[model samples]
Target: MKILHTADWHLGQLFHEYDRTFEHQAFLNWLIETINSEEIEVLLVSGDVFDISNPSATSIKMLYTFLREATAQNSNLQIVITAGNHDSASRLEAPKPLLESSNIHIIGTIEKNSDGSINYEKLTIPLRNKLGEITIWCLAIPFLRMGDYPSVANASNPYSEGVTALYREAFEFAKTRMSDNQTIIAMGHMHTHHAEISDMDKTERLIMGGVECISATAFDSEMKYVALGHIHKAQRIGGKEHIRYSGSPLPMSFSERNYKHQVVIFELENEITSLKTLEIPVTIPLLRIPLKAEPLENVLVELQQLHDKNDFEQAPYLEIQVLLEEPEPALRYKIEEVLKYKNVRLARIQPYYPNKKESTSEFNQQELLHELQPVDVFTKSYQAKYSAEVPEHLMELFQQTLIDVNQTEA
Candidate 1:
């Protein structure tokens, strides 16, 4: 069986607040072409199909078109989609039945049991080949909703067993339903254990109590192959060979520039036989330049270094860091003009005035005020020149403070 693992599409995502509709359309086109060429048997989208929970009408329309096209074009494909934290479960699940007719499965929200026990809400979707001999069971674990675990979060022993109990609700259900005869392909939209991570990956550090820092053992079940997501860097977790994160298709942040976006193609016999990754080129270019030095000669030398490095171009987005002791107004203008010619977006140009003496603890009130708003040096002068007169009652408080000081001395 051939399986394609991809995730974090983040459709309708804006890059630095700039609309990425055209870029996203290009990505989808690439995806469709690749899918057709690859002849993939199963397409698994782990999560984060949309950029936001409440996607715009245009985004929704684009998604529907893509789904329709995927269903219509791929006759042998069994497409399975799961809801991420960014998706609305109801919205994504709305067309599940209709899509099922087209061999597409939508696993959004957990299913409930008649006995009031939580069941595999979106788990164990199976596809059978002719002769009923070959069966592939897709175990989909969508974003786990905390509310689905009544026995855990709201249990009598909430301190230690809360999270463990909640996870057991799903694991226990999956264990009971799993069949040894069928080939199980598990997919989840969560951070897993021992996943190789790079500093350049755009995923922010999960805080002490964040969701992404979940225990990897939660997924240790009787599944042959595991496809995971959430971390934006494609990697294998737990050294299990089959477990993987396809990562985002594009660089979502400047920090992610070094990370190459790719999709995983897994060839399965019993376990993941072999894995091949196809690198997807970035949609838009990013440029970063570090300029350090001071004075005309020193700054000029830094500029020379940038020019010699072939970075003096205007086609890509730019991040230039200017490090100087004290750049003059004229020098700043010069740098801005040169950067403008290259069509560079100045990320930041830090001014370092090393000669400026630090203020002492015994500094006067006026000096302190000046320190507060150093750039607006004339604020104190303006206030003193044209400020409103102080009220008598407020002025008397100042006088009382002086009197209290004098009494203390006496």
Candidate 2:
């Protein structure tokens, strides 16, 4: 049986205010061709089906349309999709009854029995070949949240331990149902310990914090292949080739501009036989000018040269980085003026400044207080007291309070 593993489609994503519908559509079109050409039997989409929990109507349409078309193209192909951290479990699973009829299985959230015990049977799915023979068993586990896993009261690192425990229980149950000739595959949307993260991928870090990372040991030896999602970088965990993250189909951020996005193909001949990566063709390129920080004049010169050489239609999405001795208020305007008639679309402007270390010498407290703005002073006070940045809404309320106080004084 041939299986295609992919994740982090992030459909309905707006890349820096620019609609990525064309790019995503092109990817899906290519994927369909690949599926047909490779004669893939099972398609595993680990997670993050949409950019947000509540996706736009267009995104939802694109997802269902692709699924319907793919299944129609290859009647033998079966698809299994699990909800990622970005997905709303209920929303993703809303049409489960309809989708399953088409051989498309969706495991969005954990189900429970009437007595509140988890229904592990619902999570385990059997994958059949063209002959309708059970060839493999899939433990389709979605992103687990607090209270979603088996509870360990008073345990240290309950979240991590609970997640591991859940996988163990599911895998053990899967073992019971598996035949001697059948292979077992597991799917998850999680951050495993020691997974390499790209420098510029900020969203994943913010979403999967340090506490959420689980050890690779969580996956036992019974599993033949572990398809993972959540992380945007494609890599094998703990140097095990079978445990892999297919990564996002497209570059989600500027940090991933140089990343080679691809889908993984697993050729299972009885046991897992061969794994291959088919790199996705770049529909729209992401260009970071200067490749590194440069002076404003140098950046403008490069942009002008690039304008003369490249056509607008095929131009890459551009991000400009300028090194600065001090803050330049008109930096954006200056760059925009250069790129106004250029071929590229300006997506970001990053200003780099030299880091200045504060001295250990004594300083005047009164002078520091006098130099700070009212808002800055309040921000510092709030941070000192709470050890967190003031929330944006609270900061707005503080500004309004200042305005009211000024009016009363006047």
Candidate 3:
């Protein structure tokens, strides 16, 4: 049986205020072709089907259309999807009854029985081949939340302990169902220890002192493959090749521009499993001018070197990093003039200054409350951020804006 592991589609994502519909559609098209060509038997989407819990109607339609197309193209293909942190469990699994009829299993959240016991049947799925013979048993566990797993009262690391306990229970159940010839595979949307997250990635929650992190030992060695999501960087966890994160199809942030976004493919035959990676081609490139922050003059010179490519989706997304001695009000005009005809979409302007003071974590409540007037509050904030007093003209503008606001309220 041939199985493909992919996660973090983040469908209907808006990249830097620019609609990424074209890019996402391109990826979907490519994925359909791959499924047809590879004749993949099972497709495992670990989690994060949509960008947000409440996705736009267009995103929902895209997902359904992909599912329809995938099934129509390859009738033998089986898809199993689970919900992630960014997903609304109930919403994602609303069409479960209908989807299952077409070989699609959607497990968004834990389902309980009459007595409120976890329904292991919903979590464990059997992957059968063309001959109607069970080849592998899959533990389709979704992102675990509070109360989802068995209660581990008074445990130091309750989250990790509960997660491990759940996996063990599922693994043991899979073992009971599987024969000697069959293997067990697990899917989890979790942050495992030693997994590499993209630099400056604010999308994924940081490792808060092992509070939300679990170890690779959570999985039993009997499992053949562990498909993980939540982290956008594709990597093997704990030096083990089988336990891996397939990574996001698209770069979640500019910092992930260099990520080799790919899906993992595994072929199992006669108890031998062979795995490989299929890299997804970048539909729209992300450009960071000069590859580092530079002075406005230097950045403008480099921006001018770019040739005009006006193709809508083909035009690369750009981020400009400028080093400034002081604030330049004409910064936008300068960049726009250079990139006006370049056809590159300017996404962000990262301004950096020299002799920056690092912010401290300590908070002085008394000092904070000492600013009685709105002007004093604004002045203190401006000075703290810019490391200098607010300019006279800017201060005048601020006062005028405040006066207008006050008048409107009156």
TM-score of every model? 0.71, 0.87, 0.93
Q: Which digits, one per residue and each the tens of the lDDT, describe model 2 over residues 163-271? A: 9999999998888898878888899998888887876445554454677888889999878999999889999999998999999999998888878899999888577
Q: Candidate 2 — which residues are off by over 4 angstroms?
A: 199-203, 206-208, 308-314, 355-409
Model 1 CA deviation exceeding 4 Å by range:
130-134, 150-181, 194-212, 291-315, 324-410
lDDT of 1 at 248: 80
Instruction: Point out the higher-scoring one by lDDT: 1 or 3.
Output: 3
Cα shift from native, residue 332, model 3 (Å): 2.1
TM-score, cand. 3 vs. native: 0.93
> lDDT tens string, model 3, 1-410?
99999999999788889998888899989899998888899999999999899999999999999999999888889999999988899999999878757889999989888998788888999999999899888999999998899877798898899999999999987888878688889999999887787764445555455587889999998888899999999999999988999999999788899999999998975443778899999999998987878999999999999988668568888989999877899999999988888968898899987745764312234466554577877776766667776889989999999999999999
Whole-model lDDT values for every prediction? 0.65, 0.87, 0.87
Query: Candidate 1 — worst ten consecutive residues by lDDT sum?
Result: 306-315
Candidate achieving the largest TM-score: 3
Which 10-residue window of candidate 2 scores lowest in summed lDDT? 355-364
